[model samples]
Target: MDRLIVMKTFVTVAKSSSFSAAARELAISGSLVSRHVADLERQVGVRLVNRTARSVSLTDAGTRYADFARRILSEIDEEDTALSESRDRPEGTLSVICPKWIGTLDLGDAIAAFVKAHPLITMRFELGGMSDRNYDFLERGYDVAFHTRDLRDSNVLVRRVSELPFVLVAAADYVRRHGAPTTTAELAEHQCILHPNDPVWRLGAGAETSHHKVQHPSVVANSYLVIEKLVEQGAGIALIPRRPAVERLASGDLVEVLPQHQPPARALYAVHGPGGHTPERVRIFLDFMTVWFRSRPAAHAA
Candidate 1:
């Protein structure tokens, strides 16, 4: 018996819970399905299913094996689909979700270029706010999600594409008026724009790492863009990523404070749904995003 065919038959039986149903679904004889199950049970040396006149249920070990078998079969299907789609025409709508700041910066441009290159592909980019949940993207029908924070779920596939540098910045006027802090100890004296719960700032010095407790700002905003604007308008000093603050720094609208003690970089990751049964379009989009971000300086620059 072919191993793939046996696995498929097992999965079908497990899902339908009846040999007749499995046989009908696979368009094979019920006796053949029963024989396959018997062969699989013999190979494993255990009874997988308990069948009676009234009901058919999986045994404890059978339940676990069924889960694994389902995942294996799904992966095989996904791999086959990916290989087939690679040779065929690539045409599909690619949906993406990303944090607000990064999307506004270089990521937006890269996506635009991707769309231009693949005229047949349609793209939908959703900007995530502070309250947006990453997993909600799956429910909202997004194909991929870009995130900068650590994920808790082990099921999702996460790939670190690049690192983004963050810096403590303030408008020149604000710094001059408030006086620059020469030491981390003096950071508490100034009005800081806090990112709500993110209070610890990692200041880097050569091989050493130093953490500073930033002084809470007089005002707190959930949006990073709002924080950047507040700092740009000389509201207060804010810890912001390098890319979004680049133009302001060059134009002298915002100045990097204590550049030598800049914080450790944050990782930008491309997260996707589980690959066990992922679609070909989603896999292709994820591959493209990884390659696209890796080659861009804006995602890695300090």
Candidate 2:
């Protein structure tokens, strides 16, 4: 028999002081209750109960053991209740990891909002240093990880928060000065601002999509914010995530180069460990971010 089962049965019997009463309370047979007490006493190597024709009582050792067992069981119940209640309240440290580019973008604002909204949840947001393996973050003690692409790993649970659209944009002045490229091939004739990390520029969508390798560029930078600034200065045409480019596009500082063709949109995903019970902190954070993304004007436009 399981120790806890025998312990619980013995505790019930000790409280009621009758095998039949404990059996009735536990909804088990009287013989099973007697067997449990016998098993528990044998496990402890001591006599825990004395039975007479009319009544039942505990020995001196049984009295002390029962007291300890009662305390142990009570503490366990208290801890269990506290844990169950905590699942609803969502109070704990939530570790999250994501790519540097995505983190550097507008995700930080959502995170800041979440921190302010949920003061009880401590945040450990790490930018960059992510492994290609999706489930690696779980091994590194991360409660959640953000991905901009579809994840094929079966070991993690994936939640699609939003779609991040991309636009091939150029400053209005640059378009006027040099003339906009009508085709992907024409990009080679123009000075194109390129991010060194992702040199291959993608254009169009689905099966119609064309990938252009940017060999010669007027400017190269790791940061998209820097690239955006350079593009605003009429440096060159660059592909930018629509969220950051929305205001500039609206203000007419930037205009689309290839308006007919659309770039493939990347889905923003929040991934956590594969399990039925997701930690409350992770669930709330994901939910807050989903709401935050949906509330954004850029998301609506996307």
Error of 2 at 158 (Å): 1.3
lDDT of each: 0.80, 0.89
Top of the candidates by lDDT: 2
Best by TM-score: 2
- Candidates in order, TM-scores: namely 0.64, 0.90
lDDT of 2 by residue, 1-302 (tens): 89888989989989999999999999999999999999999999999999997768999989998999899989999999999888767788999999888998789999999999999999999999999899999999999999987898899999999877888889999999999999998989999888886689878888778999988988998888899999999999898888888878888989998887877778899999988787788888999999998888455554
| Backbone collision tally, model 1 | 0
lDDT of 1 by residue, 153-192 (tens): 7657777877777888999989879978887778888888
Q: Candidate 1: lDDT over CA atoms?
A: 0.80
**Model 1 alpha-carbon drift over 4 Å, by segment:** 1-88, 129-136, 152-154, 205-207, 276-280, 298-300
Q: Which stretches of candidate 2 lie over 4 Å from their true place?
A: 206-208, 297-302
